[model samples]
Target chain A: MTNQQCGTSRIAGCQFTLHPMSDNFVDIILSALDEVDSTKVWKDTDDVTTCVRGKMVHVFDVTKAIFLHAAKTGEHVAMSGTFSIGCPGDNEADVYMAESDEPMNLEKSQTIDQQAGCKFSLYPLGREDYMDKIYEQIDLSKARGVEVSASHYMTRLDGDVKDIFNAIEESFVAVQEKVSHTTMTFTISANSPSNK
Target chain B: MTNQQCGTSRIAGCQFTLHPMSDNFVDIILSALDEVDSTKVWKDTDDVTTCVRGKMVHVFDVTKAIFLHAAKTGEHVAMSGTFSIGCPGDNEADVYMAESDEPMNLEKSQTIDQQAGCKFSLYPLGREDYMDKIYEQIDLSKARGVEVSASHYMTRLDGDVKDIFNAIEESFVAVQEKVSHTTMTFTISANSPSNK
Candidate 1:
């Protein structure tokens, strides 16, 4: 079922998993989780994924903080996340829907110096000119100083962690403006031994 | 660039990450890696994802084997994978492209008893009736005995691991016949505490 009209309940959420390549991965993961200020969003962690649901800004803010904190540990860390908006029947109660737009951990995460490589695919569901929109975002990411390349099933991005997240967040927001239901799936890797 | 013509090269690959929700995750991951016979594919392991490239059958076979083995250990395991075919400029030298179609570890993997919960999204790049194709696959999955439901940004499938993999593989193959370039991203969870 396609939802053509954007409903008043603009629900947004992200389901993500973080993997750290180290013997002390558990410590790294738990410590990173502790660093994030997730009080602003409805957060739940299951055996498979950690999901945060609420306002768009808060959702992105929490996911970004978790990844940044893990990456700052200097251990190879990788995160896969799916961000979605405008699902057909996703009218869940959101107590934090009216939360302030300010990101809780932005200042702390910004100070972390980590380089990240990312790949993402954006789905602008039911749009005819989907490729045009996809290419436009690729161009926009490049203009924002994130190295963009064409990869199998995804667009590759390489840059500082902050810049990469900014480019991703901006492209996702841009597509939401034109398409009623849009989703982006992305993988970000930092502190990898394979880095050139 | 969307490749309209399905080239003879027929490149296929899957990049995936496996997460075991246990303190001994590294052991589980390493032991599972040992179970998969990956000689028929071009396999590479980087910091974030392990990639298997070549013929579509072998690619899926290896990825499935790894996940099944880890799940059979009675540990909560979750895997995220992206499968893609017909990418532009993907003419890498596939040494085992001419390998036999039989999956290397099919018999062994079938013996494992594991239940899996999966969510997947498919993108027929540049296709006009993409939603129709996606809906068709959803109905097809339900018909094939996989419990299909709608979730945020993905279609959910809950069933035995074998049936779930079969539905996914069949859907991917079906899309290839119509769309020149097709990609599917899926997350599968086994032995998850959140399962009903």
Candidate 2:
């Protein structure tokens, strides 16, 4: 129903918004944001690196906590992981994938795994500028291969699937107004009927 | 300030939270975000390819916009040119940092101009991780370098400089509780008038 175009880089089985111009989004964004009750600042270099590399972002913390929440609320297995990437910060020249590890046992390229919920780029419109930074983190993770992951700064979060999705939505709307273009792909694991 | 650990990486002119316990970042985030709005999403793969080159996420709209932003806000003159790497939204695997035809122009590794403020990653506490990704993007800027950019999703933003240092305090708190482990780094840009 929106004027925004859909992205080819989609997250396998899910359909998410790209760049919607509807008025509804702005209000949702304003309402969605949370208040920072307290602030904790890192004092040293060691701490900064350690925190980001160590899955120190609040969102990431929330991601882990959500898994625990699932377990606490009595769900099946709770899966969790941490992603890390090393950055030198500036390149006089040259380009490289942040994470270049090839996934083993790949039957084909870009094949969606219904079971694992294989995803593709959900890159949206007008957001072409930020891709390098965001995906570099992904590259940082893939470089580590299945054994490791990168790019979860302040993104840790969890709750009911809807809640988790809300957080993601909130994260997007949170940044939406400022960025003119944004497209995303999401792949959600199908919930087993038994869980409910 | 709070008690956090060491970090995994470092880079040029890092900036991150100083105290582990600070204040609300959501408002700061909303205020700081730079919007790339009101543009068409590039859909045709061939058109997208021609706009940038090689493998990329392919958003011609954003790629063009950043160039415009640079041309509009930066000191350089003579605009009409193609991306060193390619256009935005090339559907490439990684975030790309297009070559700076005029790249900082340092015979040795000189620092990026930090005249513009509000670079959270540049903060001392957050530098290592920020630098890690930047360096990685630089190494992989060509084939994969496009993936590592401020435009990409992974990169932390240099949000509005207005009233932001205050928010840095909040970002830390959110992250501390979100991520499992944390550390930080901070530095005053060597080129700043304050330093000069």
Worst 10 residues of 2 chain A by lDDT: A11-20
Residue A110 displacement in candidate 1 (angstroms): 2.0
Each candidate's DockQ score against the native complex? 0.29, 0.02
lDDT of 2: 0.22
Looking at candidate 1 chain B, the ten consecutive residues that score lowest on lDDT are B1-10
lDDT of model 1 at residue B77? Answer: 76
lDDT of 2 by residue, A1-196 (tens): 0111112221111111111012232232122112111122111111101111111233233332222222222212212111211122212111111212232112221131222111112122223234333433232121211221111122222223434433444434333334323323222222222221
Measured by DockQ, the strongest candidate is 1
Off by over 4 Å in 2: A1-21, A35-58, A61-196, B1-62, B65-196
Where does candidate 1 stray beyond 4 Å? A1-10, A20-35, A72-76, A86-97, A140-150, A191-196, B1-10, B20-34, B72-76, B86-97, B140-150, B191-196
> Top TM-score: which candidate number?
1
